[model samples]
Every structure is written in structure tokens, then in C-alpha cells.
Target: MGGSGSGNRWRYGIKGTVDASKRLDIRYLKQHGMLRSGYYSLSWNRGGEPTGNINVRMVSGESMTVIGKWRRDASEEWQPMEKTVYLAHTACAYGGSRSWFVCPYCSRRVAVMIIDAGYVACRHCLKLTYASCNEDMIDRSWSKRDKYKAKMGGDKGLYLKPKGMHQRTWQRLRHQYYEAEMQGWQWAAERFPMIKDWM
Candidate 1:
């Protein structure tokens, strides 16, 4: 299966069976994504000169080598008589694009509104940071700090301070929760950049 992501990012998933004795090769396909970006390169020892290109080889007669590989079109057929390579192994290159999200505290991406008063605190950081003004779909209630503490398995009021709650506490809690959750995500992203990218 293959699909396109936000901002025209492309993705492809290959899954099938290959015959080992038919001399069938699904190789010689070059990836246009990586070649345009100049991030990854591929070559073989059997060739004369190195082309710094990428290809996926399906069958090899005797593990031959090539000096350099040339960029090829990916829309070709896999043949049995041809000794080709596949370039569909290129990795993703997002170019620092943003992913969509929805949360008051999360400044990265906001795609939807959350409606949960009991966990007004951020699911990520357990901090009260967001404020929900609209009550079209769900009830807006400021979850007491005690309740949050109880749910999180900590001492009573140890993690919460209700000193200066706004009159619209529930609305504000949504905001706080979103903010705290986003911060927590940011921290986690710093620790594991690849994991954060996938998330």
C-alpha cells in the first residue's frame, strides 16, 4: 500500500512474494525523493564509475560488484533477463515540516478541541494549562486538584495548588493541560528525536 501525507509527503509499503529460482529481478528502481535532496547514495562494484545513486536489487547472478550506479526511473518493470536495481529504499525527508495536533498547551499543532473535565490536567504533564470557552459538545468543569492528585497516585494536594484559580477554572484548566502536555512532548522529543518525529 502507498499513500501521501500532509504537504505532499509520499509513502510506499511493499509486501509480496519473490521467486528465488526464476531469475526474476525486481531491482534497478531508483528513488527520486532522495536523489533530489542529496542525502543518501547508492552504488555497486561491478559497474565502471560510481554514480552515487540508490537502487534495490532483487536478484544477483553471483553477487557482482559495480563501481558507481546511475539514477534510473522507478516506473519500470521487474524482469528476469535484466540486471537492475531498485531505488525504492530511500528514507523519508520531511524538511522540517510540522505535524498537526490539537491541545491548548501544545503549540505545535491543533486539529481538534478536547472535552474532558476530569482530566483537565494535561495527559502528558498533568498540569492545568488550558481553558475551554466553548461548551457546544461537552460539559466544562474544573477538575479539583484533589481529584487529579488522587488519580495520579500522589499525596493529597501535593501536585496541585489551587491558590489563584480563575473564575472560569475549567476553561483555564484545558489550556493549562494542553500547554503542559505539549511541553512534556517537547522534552521527550529532545530525548528521542526519531521517536518524536514518528509521533
Candidate 2:
């Protein structure tokens, strides 16, 4: 039980007995609400053992205040409390490329090489989106119509002029050619709330 003074906060008895020198695991801290909001998960990247003195006080009635910081062993400095952290961009690809392709099923911006693999994957969530694509599907659906072909000059075709199209036209055609891919990218960006830092 808690008093009005302690809103959305908790004080555990372990704090009193445990030595300040002892580092507490993140999983244990989370079970105790030592971490604050905004952080997605406690990881080695942004969390570490507990450090420094803790502020423990019993207020009026049953209220109490427990304050401390964790000695996070990450690239960044220590994070005083537990916070929800999320990945900024999906780390799906191994190497960087100038052109980013979206998965048809998950809509995640994937590296071109990933398409060679049977599965299309989302970096944030390891969801296998589409099975795969074949040349037949590309030829039938993505290739331009005869009229469109003529409009671009009878000698030119969609695939023939993929790079030749204006940036605006290329963007529009890319969306149309890879509707499923675009949808996957949009879904990932929309479904997951943007976080300030990557977990």
C-alpha cells in the first residue's frame, strides 16, 4: 500500500539491506521500478550495475521516496533511471548502400542485398515479411504498358529507362512497381513509435 504523496512510485525493502557498492542487474531494477519511463528496454547498451548512494525516505503516512542512478556500461554515460528505449532505424542490412529498398510485406527500408535472401525482414521486429519475388512477377506487373512505353519514346521501356526517369517520375514508378515493398516500409515507420535513441 502507498500514500497520496507517493504517486506512481514504489519503495522496496531490499534498498535498505543491500550494500550501495553492489551493482543491481537491470532485470532486477525493472522488477523494482528503478528505471523511469521513455526507455523501451534495459540493455547492456544503455544500462549497467547500480552505482552511487540511494535516497530513501519515508514521507507522511505510508509514502516514500527512493532515488538512485545506474552505472550504465554503454557508449553513452550512466542513465540515472530505467527508461524505455527503441531503435531509430532497423539494423537489417550488413553493409550500407545508396539505394534503400522497402520490403513489400513489412515496408522496412532494406538493403538491396537482402532481397537475394528468401525472406524479407524488419530490423526492429524480426518479422519475415514476404516469401520472395520472381522475374515473371516483375515482368508482368512492373513493366510499363505499350502506351507508356511509347510515351517515353517507342524505343524506351520501363526497365530500360529505370535510371533514366526523372527523380519525381522514378519515385512514383518505384512506388507503383513495389507497392507491397512501400507498404512494408510505411507500416514499420507508422506501427512503431519513434524513439529519440536506439536501444
Candidate 3:
């Protein structure tokens, strides 16, 4: 829902991922050093501008255009910015044309990127870790229980009426939530003997 990352949200279960397009944002790509830093430009008609200010020149026309006069870095001499990216939009029974964005740094075509600290780079460059790197079943269960409790309106009681729901359905959900929460407590206790103190 919210940015659970960059904060402590006790994340568990499968985490929702960012959109594919956002990963290729020019600003992020440059910040991550996927592209060299210089007076760069872009020529994409994706309809909206990315939230960065690395552009120095831009030219638009018809269905295509180009941004250029940028270099690998500011200190270095200015050069052409590689703004020509191809996104294959057709598919057949065999397969579909993949949407590929070229990395400005290496000129390799790819679909996803690692965005962190306002910088965008390929996974290899960032050396990122999975969200579940430190996850354990016990914390996961507890997170699930918290979710259930939130859905039922806080962890105080199961019988509290949720607005606009059928009484029967609400009762069934309350029972299910109670069981899950108890199980979460059990799981957490198994991992940490002092967990009962929090309960």
C-alpha cells in the first residue's frame, strides 16, 4: 500500500513490486550510473515526464524524436545521449515482442532496473537483495495476523462490527482471524521465548 521500504513495516508474504516502466526512469537510471552523468536528453513519447532534471536539450516531432548533446559525465566532453529505445508491442502464438530499454552505461537492452536512493541501475550494478532475505516464517505469520486484525478493525476484538458487511460473513471472518492471530502468537513465541511479554 504505502512505501513499506525505507521504513519498518514488518513486511512478510509476497511483496508487491513497482511498475515495470518506473524502473526505467531516466533520472533513476542516471543516478544509479546506468547512464553516464552529463547534459543528457530524452526523446520518449510515453506521454509524461520523469521526475528528474538532467535534461539539457530535447527535440520532439511526429511519432519519434531524440534528446542529445549529453555526455558520459559532466566533467568529460559533451556527446550524444542514447535516447533511442525500442519497445516491441506486437505478439503472436510463438511469443510477443519484448519491451527493452538500453542501459546508457553498457548499451545492454533490459526490462527492469534496481532503483534506490534516487538512483537507478541494473541489478548487477546495485547488488540488491530480495525483500525476504531476512524473513522467517514466524514473523510472516505475525504479519498476516496483523493484516487480519487490521481488516477487522484493529487487534482489540473480533466481534466489533465492520461497517456494511453481512453479519454472518463478519462472524466467519472474525473466527478465522482469531485463529490466525493465535497461531501467529504461537509461531512468534517459538522463535523468541520472550514474545509472550508483548502479548
Candidate 4:
């Protein structure tokens, strides 16, 4: 999603949600040693198709300069854009320090920054929400069920205990999975009364 309106007054509607998938995460960069004084290329993909990419030049632990071309839409020409975002560090629990991106708009220290409309900013400044925020109870239950199923190394309705897993842990997860599955079915039945009779 891109920013709306023209000129310097970019309006990011509070009701809109930004895709977190296309973002620059300070932790990921630091873990990969991309925070060092060097140039790096960042790219994003959707369903195995390339969506967009950006070039970044890091100035050690100080700041990072991002260079990329972005267009508001397919009809518009690609425009070159460059932005420098500063970095902030905080002491970790055991030792060392953690790096964070200083948000250009709000100056808030954030681990991730969303890239949209050729600009990078924290989600709070953009007034955005993650896609999962909009999911209903039924959807959440289904997601939880699927998550446990996958964790046990299986697909839908075919979950199997992974090798070397503790028996008690597997049984607990199986119980929780069944609970989530039942919750989803109950909610679905409430939404569609006709399906309740069939069940």
C-alpha cells in the first residue's frame, strides 16, 4: 500500500492497514551483518513473484541510506528516492546491545519500518495495522489449529506426532488442537445455522 494525496501533505488514513511483509527490519539487518559500513540489496516477493527491491548503504551503527525507485501505481513513472534513517541502540539483558531504527517521521526507536510510496516509517507513524488484526474469532481459531498441526509436522486433518517429541507434550498439543478445531466449528455453526444440524 502506498501513501495517498499529492505534494508534501501525504495522507495515511488511520483506517487503512499496511502490509508488514514489505518492511526493513533492523534486527534482521543486524543479524545478517548488513548494519556494517557496506551496501546491500533488499528485495520482497509474493507467491514466488518479485514485488520490489531497494538498495541500502550502511554507515556502521550510525545510519543507513536507502536508495530505490518506486511508483505510486503502474500508470505512473518510477521515481528515484533516497532516505537516510538513523539508528538507536539499547543494552540487552545478558550482554551486548540491540539495534533499532530511528523512525524518520516520529523519531521513535522501532525494530521494523514499513516501506510504502517510496518512503519508510514506523507503523505507528503510518497509523497502520497488521492483517491479522482484522481477523475474526473463527479465523483465529482456524489459524491456531493449523499452527499446532503444522508444528506437529502434518497438514490439515492429518496431524502426526513428530519424531523425538515428548509424549506428554504431544498429547497436550493434540488436546489444544482439538479444542481450537471445536471452537472454529462452533463459531461456524453459529454463523451458519444450517451447518449445525449436519454436524
Which candidate leads the pack in lDDT?
Answer: 4
Ranking of models by TM-score: 4, 3, 1, 2
Tens-place lDDT per residue, model 2, 70-183, is 443556565454211111233337763222334445555543212111222233233222222111222322233333444444444444555566867754544454564444
Model 4: CA > 4 A from native = 1-20, 155-162
Model 3 agreement with the true structure over 1-199: per-residue lDDT tens digits: 2221322235444433343222445445435543432344433333485432234222211111233353345687865433434322334468844334444455455555433333344544555445444445554555666776777778444757777767887777777776776876776676567977888
**Residue 82 displacement in candidate 2 (angstroms):** 8.9
**Span of ten consecutive residues with least summed lDDT in model 2:** 112-121
**Residue by residue across 1-199, what tens digits does model 1's lDDT show?**
1111211112232221111111112122122332231233344332465323333232222121112222224565432221212122223386543222223353322322122221111233232232332211112212243344443344523445455654466445545654554544554455457756666
Clashes of each: 38, 15, 2, 0
How does residue 133 of candidate 3 score in lDDT?
A: 43
Clashes in model 3: which pairs?
28-120, 32-120
Residue 40 lDDT (model 4): 99
For model 3, the local distance difference test gives 0.48
Summed over model 2, clashes come to 15
- Global lDDT of each candidate: 0.30, 0.34, 0.48, 0.81
TM-score of each: 0.18, 0.16, 0.43, 0.82
lDDT of 4 at 84: 93
Give the Cα error of residue 67 in candidate 2, in Å: 1.4
* lDDT winner, 3 or 4: 4
Show where candidate 3 strays beyond 4 Å: 1-86, 90-112, 116-133, 155-157, 194-199
